[model samples]
Target: MPAPRVSVRTRIFELEMVLAGAQPPVRRRVQVPGEIDLAVLHEVVQSAMGWTNSHLHEFEIAGRRYGIPDPDWPSQDVVDETKGKLFRLVEQGDRFGYVYDFGDNWTHEITVEKITGAEPGVRYPRCVSGEGACPPEDVGGIWGYEEFQAVMADPAHPDHDERLEWARGSFDPHRFDLDETDRALQWLAWRPLAPVS
Candidate 1:
């Protein structure tokens, strides 16, 4: 018999969370297509959060990526819903900030900011969990967040001056206006939610 075809669908949902320093609350949601395979979906999220396939599955969202598994997260269902919503929010903006699974319940919260430059000044620093560099070691590339920050902070370090200069350069905060907010909401308001089979 022929194999049964797998069905996939994408849905958007609005997510609201109370951030550390913000009053009221932070609200935003993005539409993400659902995947037939939970493993694949997990991989995509892990990649976005700077984890490679080799890393052990730990309920921690630190080390380069902001949203990993945390101890204080809500139930699994709520966490999944929050993650899906946050993904869409990040995809929509030029730059965004997220704090996931911070407190009990592993709630993932994100803030999408507006990008001003012609080019999106966003950087996805991949985590180096001892993965063999794709290219041979000869070629140099950008370092991960920890390494980069360390180098930039240490004035005595060789790359500190250059890294510091790069960090100091002026950049616009990617904040959305009322119209963009409405658009994001509309997108999520109409999205369909279904459990992954």
Candidate 2:
């Protein structure tokens, strides 16, 4: 007998990150290995949400905060996200919170929708579907996003031209390409580096 053929289990989560009052929330349906730690989940979230991974982030569940604790700054109130496993913290239908960029307070509400077995040949962590584009990083959170949208929509706004120019390559607040997201996931999962001599 071939070691009883163990099967890999996966968890599917429906993550929604919304700027309160902002029209059309950003949502992602993601699947990950059940045993993966929260740190990996953080990466999954970043990949799924079109985030640049340039800011600090934290996960809050059951009243505890999880993130990469700065050893130099011990006062930071967070446990290592690497130490917490998703299966240990939540089950199907559980909801938690994630906050990225503490200064801007970009918060996301995460819900565990289903627990299922991994499909053969499919990537462990990938975004199956999503809606809306993520807000630009360093845009001062929800309020700033809303204001930025307003300004961008009205070319006559005082700072419209400057903001548009600044946001040149990433000003599309309405675009969400599944292929782009899947490509990002593939790249993040397996990127080639220079081979060792």
Candidate 3:
């Protein structure tokens, strides 16, 4: 059978001054109803940083960082990777970054084959901007497997039809299958870091 459809939604919530002495004070939140599209997430982050695909820079996700190389600051892997792709330098700081292959067919949706440190169940509603300051939240119990599957099946679901079509037309079941989904869950299931590493 073909892989089930995956529905993902992006919603932004605005926060105002609810009370005084609040540490965060005010903030806007983005919520995804289901699994997040890391590629789309990456695009949102880059846009917030005032960068575009044409511009190159090193960035970090999870705990790892990668980007275009500079003579002053260099990463051998990044330099080698960007040989043909033009990129600009990105300053060091706390941020989330992601990289994925969309495959040869341009119509294919990019599958998040690798994620830096974003684990399943880890909440990153505020991290939508890629700033590292947003502490991860616990989303483990927010939705169950049955709920997720239902969302995928619902035609009214925001990403249901689109993600399903993408999967049917672009995804290679043999290469990207149920195992990949399980991996994503495994990552999300990890708890936030404690005081010590």
The number of the candidate with the highest lDDT is 2
> What TM-score does prediction 2 earn?
0.85
Ranking by TM-score: 2, 1, 3
- Per-residue lDDT of 7-125 in model 2, one digit per residue for the tens? 44344444444434445677777766666789878888888887888999999999999999999988878899999998899888888998888898888888888887655555656
Model 2 RMSD in Å is 6.6
* Tens-place lDDT digits, model 1, residues 35-122: 2222333333333332234432322222224224445753432233234333333433333233332221222233223212111221
Error of 3 at 47 (Å): 4.1
Worst 10 residues of 1 by lDDT: 130-139
The runs of at least 3 residues in candidate 3 whose Cα sits more than 4 Å from the true structure, single-residue gaps closed, are 1-28, 32-38, 47-53, 66-75, 78-197
Which scores higher on TM-score, 2 or 3? 2
Quote each prediction's TM-score: 0.26, 0.85, 0.22
Report the C-alpha lDDT of model 3 over 1-24, residue by residue, as the tens digit. Answer: 432222222222211101112122
Q: Give the Å shift of residue 136 in candidate 1.
A: 17
lDDT of each: 0.30, 0.75, 0.29
Q: List the candidate 1 regions with Cα displacement exceeding 4 Å.
A: 1-10, 13-30, 35-37, 58-148, 158-197
